[model samples]
Target: MAAVSRWPENVVVFLYAVFFFHTFSSAQRDPGYTFMHQATTAPIVSYYDYIIVGGGTAGCPLAATLSQNSSVLLLERGGSPYGNTNITDLAAFGVALSDLSPTSPAQRFVSEDGVVSARARVLGGGSCLNAGFYSRAGHDYVRLAGWDARLVNESYQWVEKVVAFQPQMKQWQSAVRDGLVEAGIRPYNGFTYDHMYGTKVGGTIFDQNGHRHTAADLLQYANPSGLTVLLHAPVHQILFNNQEGSKPKAHGVIFMDANGLSHRAYLNRGPNNEVIVSSGALGSPQLLMFSGIGPKEQLDAHNIPVLLDQPLVGLGMSDNPMNAVFVPSPQPVEVSLIEVVGITHNGTYIEAASGENFASGTRTRDYGMFSPRIGQLSTLPPKQRTQEAIDKAVEDMQALPQSAFLGGFILEKIMGPVSTGHLELTSRSPNDNPLVTFNYFKEPEDLQRCVDGMKIIENVIESNSFSSFRFHYLSIVTLLNMTASSPINLLPKHANASRSLEQFCKDTVMTIWHFHGGCVVGRVVDHDYKVMGIDSLRVIDGSTFRNSPGTNPQASVMMLGRYMGVKMLRQRST
Candidate 1:
């Protein structure tokens, strides 16, 4: 027989007991109101008072509010974010964005103009994937959009209570804050959720422990008995009842379950029973076009029946163009994102974030615009541009030795781009991604604004406070010279420096992912968010914004959702 173990008998017994409890107690408790993935055995009912497509940043909150007195079915294409460490942990931020898996929360797509971007496919929408920065929509923006000022304020409070937090600024973010003030963006407003002109620290969704509190957390307000959230439920089509000489009514939706099983949920016969499409900027427009609600000519070409000849459904798309100057630091800095923001007087917004070395093994995705694969200046198929950019990025990374620590100071010019883009159907299939042409810098003024923004960033980096950081400015001129659009002068002293800057803008400008205005309030939807020429359907997401809010949009999007939900509730009551 083997010699008797000398370990304490009580310890051995305790370990065995713990192992047994762990194995059995791991079974999740039914929260009753909690989410259910497609693989689950719970049957989706055939009808509900309201069916919300896309359980995203807007949809989650909207669904919860609507469910207060109505039976609501919230359908989401992606799975829940509960246990996804890639999304919940701030340290894994890049990992979540870079994930190319089919079930990744971030869905990677290439625009028609060859720009690569990833849209949120998971619940909580972009909130699950973004840098977790939060800011209110500008008061001017609220007024311009025709939103009720009082209601919008209340909506912000509703959301802030659940997800917003005041961030404790660390070494790097603190330095950036002082630098922005020194660079002339002054009268530091301190920490606030209000979007104001000047340097200020905004709210963040990340807690002090670096845990992300997503918009999904707002679902806690949901009426458990009235709400049913189905994950992995991709809504393919909005079931409509078209009658002769009458408006097309959205009665239900056809979505696929986790097992690829088809399911349909229809609205109750009540007059107020309706369907709301809160699918995000790209998704809401794509779904509208798919449901034959876009340009008549484009829909005809795709051989789809037109429900509403709404030419503006997928048009007027725009995104904030971002040009980043990377400053490599000699020592490791604390990881942060969008803590201190500088709202420049010159229609620009300068923000700084600290990140790990881009060349580090942990960062698998090629994120920078000048990345060799995606940044190469070549006349290639539009679809190949993103791949090429990635490849070029990889090549550049291969040349750099992995550093122990790298700090990044990013500049984002959030304003003054009048140029707009559009989204069109590449195919009639719902699974086929849309052709998104951001048409960035199509206007000369837009390019000039970007150049001015870049100059401001250079000044901030050269400021006395930031000098101790030992910064090495990555020159846009040198990068442009290497690209196909090379042989251009970007030096400040050059006579045609503006022109060179324009060329550089064309070569290197990429999206900061602040996309908006595909479905304008006045054109596509009314002040109440009701879709024009259609009954019982509304679009209540970023796509409905009349213009970009000149700040991070998560807070605005959530506020809109809450505002719309309250409006609908009051209407139903009356």
Candidate 2:
């Protein structure tokens, strides 16, 4: 035995040395380096503890959060990851990525048959491609819409933590801030946890590491365990059992993968199994109706066989319509995000005390914060203090310092009059995308408010402050449709003379991508985020927001997804 050991000693040492060297070399190499392998076979049906539909703004977060402890199946209709410099960093440069052509696949769909839908369809969903603004909505809007302060506040905190939403390091630009100040519209950091009205001035811009923030950062950073993020998997219809009851209980979902192949999966419901819908406003409702959970009349028309008589499923589609009246910048606005955040807290607190000035009645809500007043405005008498506050806010915003270049602006016209829109199934073929119409400016007051908002912007641009900047107006072709031109063109036009004041004001209607209230809380899902009238089903996203919050909705949606994930986990624990 001693003689044999001596002979093998050198051989063992050599093998061990070679193994260590290979392992060390492998670890030192680039992590992303891999032999590219083409996906040859289409993936067949797979089961999971949780199934989340949509890969957009809300869905991505939901999947990332839920899959933290358990397996999650995230399905997106768009292609694989295609990261661009602008899409990953600058918030202002995201929309422009669409022009990259050939590389930026069309994740959006066409509604009204001919009209294109601006919703994202890829893996990171809309977050991968949204204007990386992390604006929080006013608390009042959440409470008014039946959500308690506890839930809303928790949601806010959850989102801020997950996304690490830092305010702009520097002020957006003194010109825009000063212009608002000139308008008597005190700039209030709109993301403040309180008031959305009153005599305030200035606000914060959301950014990430000196660049514009996106959900991709959060999801990738979190790195949920046992989660499969499969892009190009568009859900066609939810499979439900008719005999279950009035509201059909969803059995599972059917989707189309990247190769246009059909696949299906089933959910067991409760305990380990749960299904969630975070498919944004348009996609969520369409999924419901196709699965037999919408207005009876509409469902029957499309031969979807009603599962739940949810008239409100797709009836309350809402979006912020803006008349972005670009004013000439003395110089191109080139402030970095780090510089922007540095000023947000300073700006928010500086004007916090003025929030109460816009209060009406008991002043139960924060006045200085950006509140969603349009929902309540219609109820206020034309002479009431609430209406007065809106008017004053609009007036002040118009007169803001460098009002034309204040980074971004919000006015009454953008809130809009509440109007109904349809999300009807385009064909019995559930694989196709549903039809959507925003029906902007449905009410006479809405049109009038737009005119007023535009007039204010026009007045601000023509003001003495904008004298040094070059300007142009939106093209006639762009005005007729929101999807006609990329959002890239949104800032080009500064001169009112380029288009008649009436044309610029009347024709220009743009979306802030703040769609909400389609699958509202009460009508579609319970406050617990569970789908009403269905078992083992839930909705957690902007689509579940019963009403439009008073500001950017990304924070709120992310919060809701987190809340739902935590609650579901806790319930399972018991």
- The digit string of per-residue lDDT tens for model 1 on 381-473 reads 234555645656456556665552366655666573588888888885555578788888787667777787767776676677776664355
lDDT of 2 by residue, 1-574 (tens): 5765777778878877988865443212222312111122335676778888876666766766776677777776665443343344342232332232423533344334122235655555566545444555665566665655676677566556545453442323334444444544444343343334422222222333433344443465334455666665667788766673364566678877556677887774455577788777777887887778888988888777766787878866666554443223334344332111111211111111111112222322221112222211111222232435545644544454542332222232344235556676677553455677666666555565555554444433344443444233533233322211223233234444433433433334444456666787777778777788887788777777644554445666666666567667666677
Span of 10 residues, lowest total lDDT, candidate 1: 23-32
For model 2, the superposed segments whose C-alpha errors exceed 4 Å read 1-43, 80-82, 91-117, 162-172, 187-195, 198-212, 220-223, 242-247, 269-272, 335-413, 428-433, 455-504
Name the best candidate (by TM-score). 1
lDDT of 1: 0.75
Error of 1 at 243 (Å): 2.5
Q: Quantify all predictions' global Cα lDDT against the true fold.
A: 0.75, 0.51
State the TM-score for model 2. 0.68
Model 1 TM: 0.87
Clashing pairs counted in every model: 12, 44
